[model samples]
Target chain A: MLSIEHLTLQLPYYTSWWRRRWAEVLSDVSLELHPGEVHAVVGASGAGKSLLAHALLGLLPEPKHQTGRLTFQNRALTAARQRQLRGRELALIPQSLDALDPLVRSQRQVSWAASRAGHARSDAWQAAGQALTHYQLDERGRQAFPHELSGGMARRVLTAMAHVSHAQLIIADEPSVGLDPQQRNRVLDALAALALEGKSVLLITHDLRHALPIAQQVTLMNQGRCIETACASAFRGDGDTLATGYARALWQALPDNHFGVLTTTQAQNVA
Target chain B: MLSAYRLHHAFADQTAVLDNVSLSLEAGEWVGLNGLSGAGKSTLGQLLAGHLTPQAGVIKVDGAAPPRSGLQPVQWLPQSPELSVNPRWRVKRILEEAWTPSTALREAFGIEPGWLNRYPSALSGGELQRVCVLRALAPGVRYLIADEISSMLDPLTQLALWQALRQVADERRLGVLVISHDAALLERLCPRRLTLSEGRLSPPARHGAQSA
Candidate 1:
């Protein structure tokens, strides 16, 4: 239910204490995310994937200039509107567990999210408990502070917070990083379950394999540029069905595939 | 050879994190260790690298105690490079802390010259990781304890890193202990693969793991 067309962002960088230089952080990126669809944005770290999430959430810092058109439900998405809709219609599943409060309990944190989204305190508490239970967190897990939870348990708590927000669109940035394979799959499966329930999910990550199975469409991003957006099925069987040469090379370089490292001439794109 | 003999470690008020664990790596050997989370793989690696002293065990380099101070022979590269680095320090100072690497080595690791002036917080996670790996490859180091270093990287960046490290390991006879959960990655880079579970090591069951 979101559409971005020719989006570009430039951040001002200080130079010599007297002048400012504009650095292109994102350029000419476009995508269409539909309801009930999980769209994967795959790129190397530092390819501006997180920046894209920030732009959508209206969290980008000041002294930034942009040229873009963001449409949600056929309505123009201004920065003020983005700020207003955040946590109500748009929720972000942050990449770091540090986003959680150290002193507060897990269930309380999740309920706070629900309350911020306009739920009454009593309803929010019940929703938080239900969300945590759906993620398989027992009563003890729900009551534990952030430090007490394991890596996987902490991740499930983040997912639970997003669930209570009841947002129409969710953005998860590198949600599976540092999680073991089993925990990684659990988080990915949870995101897929959200999409199954008709929430639009924007999964931004570097790992394509985990995203491919759950995502119907994939956007390949390079340094400040969107190289190609292709159907997830095109990533299979040597990636010959893929449109961009970079995507094919990336597919071939997978450890389980041909394990081909891009030659130096072509390495500049990913590096 | 770098070896750990009958290592034992346990946190206070808890059961043994490690139990009579022993492992050996000859020069230039590449070994992979995989396990479920909290299964003591990192504990074993830390014990081997001297980051954590096992309550009862001996770690030896060529059958002798390793040097107690200065540049260590075994370097540990953790999963999160950001936490490992000094955020206030510039990349140049960070890389030069242990030793200054040659330009050729920097190129191999894909470290850009412009990054040297930037703080660690300014660089992306992958770039910081490459810098950390290059920094750890000092002339005195002989073995590397790579704990999920490339698990955060994309496949292409992952391949690029292993390729570069392989060249140096071959030249320097560096023994590498790779700790990861990616069975496909373990299978590809290491000929001798072992799984850590319940404070013990065993050969991985080849049929169950998904390919990367």
Candidate 2:
């Protein structure tokens, strides 16, 4: 089980003059994801959702302030207490693919992840291969460098690495952002498969429609606060379903529709 | 106007990223390029903006061929934000590196006064992206090839950013080509849409459906 009680995070001090003026990043945020279920957090950009993800993985950057409780399977998460749970019990799929070491090969990164959980290198290699195949990655892709892989391929490799770590809880942040519709469905299904096997998932994204079909429950966040939390079924009705209403409101605020169109030559002349 | 004829680019391994791509964008048109990852939508956009050279075709911007290096007549916003701007530089400095001065850039970006001194790390993803759009638009470049600028932002922010881009296109009379897989977003912003398939561009039967 995963539980967070009133968890909060603050940005660290920076030498730059601008960093000092920005407001505290996260404030009094609290939510939870239970075993065998998918709890999705949907919010606008700059709402501190990513920071909350960082806080959960104990990966927040230096000099940040954090309070409240983070517990997995009844054990609290502290810098000291989380040492043993780093890989096996808790794992993170970060936003940037470059988060991995640039010098190391992709396969070695997955193997290293497994060894951190006390597995032998040979066993780790086999397990890594198995995970990669399970994720539908080409067997030969294991030898390729990060620079050689496409964005979607890199995401799959990261998932394979996460699987090798044997994490009880997986947190994926906007895992399908740049992928095509088909790839997005594949990635979402894989994560859903993990939840079916009793592993908890904290799926964070901005599109409620993307998560509504996959998530068992959904939490809508706006401006640093979670304004709504309910089962996906509650939003299934027609004509302004909760999810659609929010989406429409957000879409209407976009600047594209606000401006009138320009003729070809006039627009072209500006260049 | 932007046009490419019989465009082809091959990598060292003899793999073709863009194969004989032929497309054109008239002024005042909002074109959305749709493709699965690695479908080479970005490559075609780069070719139009003179960011990349095609091995076998001709590209023209406003009826003129562009040079390989230096700023071409068309402007380009790259895929990765980290690569789009210098991390160590302050936001103001990056914008200044473009053709515009500080006052004009701030006005176009809706940036509050005195916000330019902050570095990219200090800004949120949305803020950084807004800054990037401003920098790209600052040079007053006419043709814009924006490769998935909204992919990293949340819905609310994406909406805002698209609106800003649409306004720029209208005000500047710029030919804007947005590359993305978000069907809803494309439908909302673009009047003419093309799907990149097997390195070829074609109109989809349905406005925003994924063509197989």
Candidate 3:
């Protein structure tokens, strides 16, 4: 389990020797992840969803100030502890395919992750093959380089690598971008299956429709602030049960829904 | 009018990515191309925009071959706007190099004045994409091929972009080809839709004739 309490991050820009301006990138964010549950964080482009992920992973940019209480498995998550847990107990499924090495074969890359997670080399290789197969990659696909794979195939390879590590918590950041509807559903279903196996997942995305089916709980963020956290079931049938006006507006804007007008706050936050 | 006839393309592996595909667009018409991933929809867009030469068949605008040099009437907006522009160049240079957009056009696209001096890396993906859309709608462009241009953007930004594009197309009578996997978006923006499957282009289906 993971819990973040009142997390805040600020970046300082020095205008002069003694004058500095601080920009608040994240503010008073709190979230809790239970074991075997899929929690989704949905927001627009500048809503700081990815920033929250980086902060949790200890991958935030420098020249910043951070204050937060993060606990994992009932233990405080210090920087050292994060480094120790990273890639073993916690793993990130990065948004870009460039996270993969262009020259390395897909299976080999996955095996490397297994090796890092403390598997023997021979065992790592075997697990990598199984992992690739589990993700529906074929024999040729396992041997293909990252560039040789299609967008959907490359995404599956990333998922395979993450699974081979056997991380307890997987942070997937927009894993379905550029994918077709079927491929998108496949990726989401794979994540859901991971949860079914008792792994906690934090699904970060802009599309609420994609997130609604698999997500047990949803947190709505806007302009670096967490607006509301509600049950995924609450986001249906006109959004009357939703707490905030912005959240209701977002729900209404869905194509399958009314496709209604966006509130000024929603429009400004999005554009 | 813009037309492609029996277009065929293959890569070094000698496998056809596109086969005998053909489509056409009349002036002021917004057409949608829908397909699954790796279905050669992007390859067909590239061929129509003259970014790639087909092994066989022909693509013509007004029954003439697409111009190889000078100001092109057909323009392409790729999925990744960051890759389309020169990173070293300032945003002002990138915009002016293509064509000087009217002041109204820049404002309508929500391009900030300060952004003009910054490099591409300093801008966000949505901002960069707005610049790319503006560049594609430059003076001489008559037909626009937007290949998943708004796929990475959020819903509100995506809606803003499509609205701006529709307004521009109507005012300029530009023939626009929007390539996307989003059926909702395709239905909303285009009256005529074409589906591509297994290296083939299906006949156009006239959906709702109602205006967006």
Instruction: State the TM-score for model 3.
Output: 0.92
lDDT of 2 by residue, B22-122 (tens): 77777878888899888888888877777677889988877888765566668788767767888888877887685664565456555655457667776
Error of 3 at B142 (Å): 1.3
Cα distance off (Å), candidate 1, residue A62: 1.6
Q: Pick the candidate with the highest TM-score.
A: 1
lDDT of 3 by residue, A1-271 (tens): 9999999998665444578778687899999999999999988666788888888888876778999899999999988898898889998998878899999999999999999999999999999999999999999999999988989899999998889889999999888888999989989999999999999999988888789999999998876889899999999998889877778877876656766555554654343
Model 2: lDDT of residue A172: 83
TM-score of 2: 0.88
CAPRI-style quality class for the chain A–B interface of candidate 2: acceptable
User: Looking at candidate 1, what is the lDDT of residue A10?
Assistant: 95
lDDT measured at residue B159 in model 1 versus the true structure, 0 to 100: 89
Which candidate gets the maximum lDDT versus the true structure?
Answer: 1
How big a share of the true inter-chain contacts is recovered in candidate 3?
0.37
lDDT: worst 10-residue window of model 1 chain B:
B203-212
User: DockQ of candidates 1 onward, in order?
Assistant: 0.67, 0.44, 0.48
Residue range B64-128, candidate 1, lDDT tens digits: 89888998899989888998899988899999999999999999998999889778977889989
Per-residue CA lDDT of candidate 2, range A23-82, in tens? 466666777788989888877766777777778877766776777898878878887656
Best by DockQ: 1
